[model samples]
Target: MNKKPNVAIVGATGMVGHAFLKVLEERNFPVKDIRLLASGRSKGKKIKFCGNDFKVEELVKGSFKDIDIALFSAGAAISKEFAPLAVKAGAVVVDNSSAFRMDPGVPLVVPEVNPKAIQRHKGIIANPNCSTIQMVVVLKPLHDAARIKRIVVSSYQSASGWGKEAVDQLWAETEQIIKSRIQHPGSSIKVDGVKKVLPAQIAFNVIPQIDVFLPNRYTKEEMKMVNETRKIMEDDSIKITATCVRVGVFISHAEAVNIETEKKLTPEEATEILRHSAGVEVIDDISKEKYPLPIDAAGKDASFVGRIRADESVENGLNLWIVSDNLRKGAALNAVQIAELLIK
Candidate 1:
């Protein structure tokens, strides 16, 4: 058998980085040497892999010397700084940041939707935004079957998408609410819970913002889905709009998607296609109340599609809901899949 490739996971201590380890192991990808790279504070921390301890290394300019493929999930700034160095060192970089997604030369890839796009990469390939990734993966096959004229998406994103600090904020605020409930059973803020943390508390409430707002009033996360969908699907004519909101859930980014198709498809037809679609699972069954939920989808790799119905107002419109572990398929698993493509 051929030797397994040497791989490096940048930001190995972050949420997405930790998910990458699980995806790689679950898929049984051939990994000869796995280099775990993190920040200075995390360096020397032991990450056990295959029953052996691997010390995390601090990321530096020369860290990619012998790495064959680098999966980067640190952040956009770090990717902007070090991705090129990894490429120069002869490693194909699969970056999970927005730094290069819209770059004309770099391919924004979702393996299930556009694996062929990987062949056009110039050393660096970008994974689409978490919300965009699952939406497109579920929509692409249908779009290819019947052209998609317009797409409207609303995202219920988890705090973990913002990284560990945001996750901590959610948990802390939640615990505070629980304690308050126990102390003051009849208080006004009892069931509603706390509503402000970091300018807006996300305890038992949903915040209508996920990232910094742009001049157009849409958050950066919304713009990512709008632009990145066109680039990844290779269809600039597909009109897209999005509203991303942060939810109180611990994991899984869920989306309420509505698409106007050039041709009509019944709910059954759509569900049939989604069930067999690559990397997607159709879990719509109203009679038995079997549908995808955020808690049910947490930690799973596949994007779940449910609540499929035809829009009565529009001529050829379909409405659906989708959920997936944003940290996995949205970030880590997609980046790791790109590395697998390079190895092939």
Candidate 2:
């Protein structure tokens, strides 16, 4: 820890992986060396770091031999198989997958929320789901103040959340729609493209299902919110219900959240609390039609919150809208912050 640590970015060719590199460069994270590892298809690919090019290596047993910290954004199965080997190779792993999150031993973390949980990691630190990360960052300060009892959240997740292929699918589908509109002139028409994402196409519409469905009818993505929230909050009794939807946007992930607290909150008071919280930016101003939008938060690290008000339907209920760059704070940036905490 005396000198800057040598780091490895697992899945370095993926979208989240690319963001990790960007954040590391933007924040000027001290790295004596960097190893960008990906699958065989991406091997030998070059990515720029600090204006210098580095060749991507295929991940293997010895990949982490000299690495001190590993940031894992590969999918869960990859993380499940490779994370331990990296840890055994003497590197601390911060995983951005659902692999080790509920493992009782691994720390489920949002640096802004339960940073104290970092000390509990058994080699792998789990970054909560992207949607969960943004929601909890905004909730922790409020929950600390009012004690959240139950949370109901519906996410408008971007195509990027499903990975690069989904983003490409969205672009391809959108182009087809534009072409169809031009050909049809004033007549209404529907265009369909090769179905590369979701069950169907993802153009000019929203897909309510995200990830795969479970026997209980809720998606695995939805369950991640419930389980991850409880673990990150360190309160098993906290109730959470989530509906994860895939949207056509290609960057930020947005959510509509309603919470039941132990105590009542006024809109003015809630705004005051969030205004003073770290890593939170309030953008509510109906008079000027100003509010948090996906594009506004596409490249930002902070969570943008707006539309704060008390729910009239239930006592002690508060409603909020939250958005953030999923690839940043949701995955890469959060992992980088955890690494910073560890090295400190």
Candidate 3:
């Protein structure tokens, strides 16, 4: 590997793709060259990186040639087709889609949790789902201290998790609601004629579903948290369940995670453990009104944890509040961290 790798970003025009460039530049990743690839629709679009303008190129069979690392944020279909091509072209792929995550051959990675898994990559590494990434980073250290027996997590995800259109939909819905209030003053405000990217109206509302529901009644997003958490933690015996909700916030994702551990850990003990853990920030001073908030976590890399307390109903149960920028630590930054591991 060169001291400065030649990198290519798939889906370079999407939200997470743009984040890839931002995180890479912020970290000063050593990149000898960068190729931005997207679908035909985004071709020739200009994106600025490191003070230089780069043209987005249409992704094709030959796009990965001479690329040392390919960071893929395109959807699963695109990754399923092109990731292998990137591998065949001798570029190691760090895919940020669900395409290869469950594949036993691919390491479902969150750098703060299972970084050594990156060593087993068979030409590609899978970044776990955004929600899974943040949760696991906070849980891993505690899991080590007092083996996690079962986990129940409810996520308050942001609009950006669905991509750019969903965010636009949120903004448009809010504007419409505000305008209706100003005009009618007392009538029930109704949002109309906005392109529906989410399953329900997201302004001032929360949707319990994220991805489509499976026969088991869990949405794919929820199941991803359940399945990926076990895989990344390397503990298939652990019981895990999740309810993923799409909230109106535009940036960070927050989770209320309750865990039953094999051994007891008090709130104070848990706080001390997480404080020293990598990629985790402890912000729990409740009396002073300090805790992890999505707005405060936006654009930050750390997984913030607060509200640590014992779940007294059950023995050895603990609860935690976790928050992180869904686009950064949850997606692009995690991918970039994997690439950094590759070079080392």
Candidate 4:
């Protein structure tokens, strides 16, 4: 790796792609040069970074030439096609897609959880799902203190997790609902439009499904959390289940995570452990009603944990509320941290 690497960002016009640039600049990553590449439609678009305007070029086989680190967020299909090309071009890819995450050859990494996995990458590293990234960061310290046996998590994900279009849909539907309420009082509020991104109306509603349902009746997003958590923790024996939901918020994801550990840990003990852990912020204070909220966690890199309590149903059960910005720590920051490790 170069002391000052030349980087390329695939999907430069997308939501997580924009986040990649923001986090790279905020952390002052050493970069000799940068190339912004996207789909053909986004070609010639101008994106400002580090006080300079760069034109977005259409991604192709030649895009990875002379690039040291390539951060990919274009999606699984694009990654499956171009990631190998990037690696063949001598640019190590840190992909933010599911294309190679479950591959035995790829290391699915969250810097705060399994940073050592970065060293084992064979020219390509995989970033876990956004939901999985935040949950695992909070789970690692607790799992180390008392080995986790089983996990049950329910995610309240924001529209931003889908993409920029989903966010626009949320606001558009919100405005329509508000106008209907104001004009036709005592009538049902309805949103009128052909829904494009989300499965159902997301305005003032929550959908329990994220990705397509599998034969096992679990959505793909839910299964990703279950599998990715075990892989990152390196403990296949740890039983995991998840219910992913899409909420009306525009940014940040919140999860209600319940875990059963082999050994008991009190709320105070767990709080102390997480407070000292890297990439975790303890925000629990029930008396004054202070806890992790999606609004408060937006644009932040740390995984916020709160609502610490003991589940009385099980012998060694603990509950937590975890929150983080889906685009930052969940996707861009995690990939950037892996690149940082590569440079180190």
Error of 1 at 329 (Å): 0.6
Greater lDDT among 1 and 2 belongs to 2
> Over the stretch 223-299, how does candidate 2's per-residue lDDT look in tens digits?
99999999898889899999999888999999999999998878888899999998899999989989999998999
lDDT digits (tens) for residues 172-238 of candidate 1: 7677778766433333232234333343667677789877899999989899999999998899999
Q: How accurate is candidate 2 locally (lDDT)?
A: 0.90
Instruction: State the local distance difference test value for candidate 4.
Output: 0.94
Residue runs of model 1 more than 4 Å from their true location after superposition: 1-3, 182-199
Using lDDT, rank the candidates from best to worst.
4, 3, 2, 1
Candidate 2: pairs in clash: none
All-Cα superposition RMSD per candidate:
3.3, 2.5, 2.0, 2.0
**Clash-forming residue pairs, model 1:** 196-201, 197-200, 197-201
Q: Model 3, stretches more than 4 Å misplaced? A: 182-194
Pitting candidate 1 against candidate 2, the one with the higher TM-score is 2
Predicted structure 4, TM vs. truth: 0.97
- Clashing residue pairs for model 3: none
Question: How good is model 1 by TM-score?
Answer: 0.94
Per-candidate TM equals 0.94, 0.96, 0.97, 0.97
- Name the lDDT value of residue 298 in candidate 1: 85
lDDT of 3 at 44: 92
Positional deviation of 238 in candidate 4, in angstroms?
Answer: 0.4
Runs off by more than 4 Å, candidate 2: 182-195
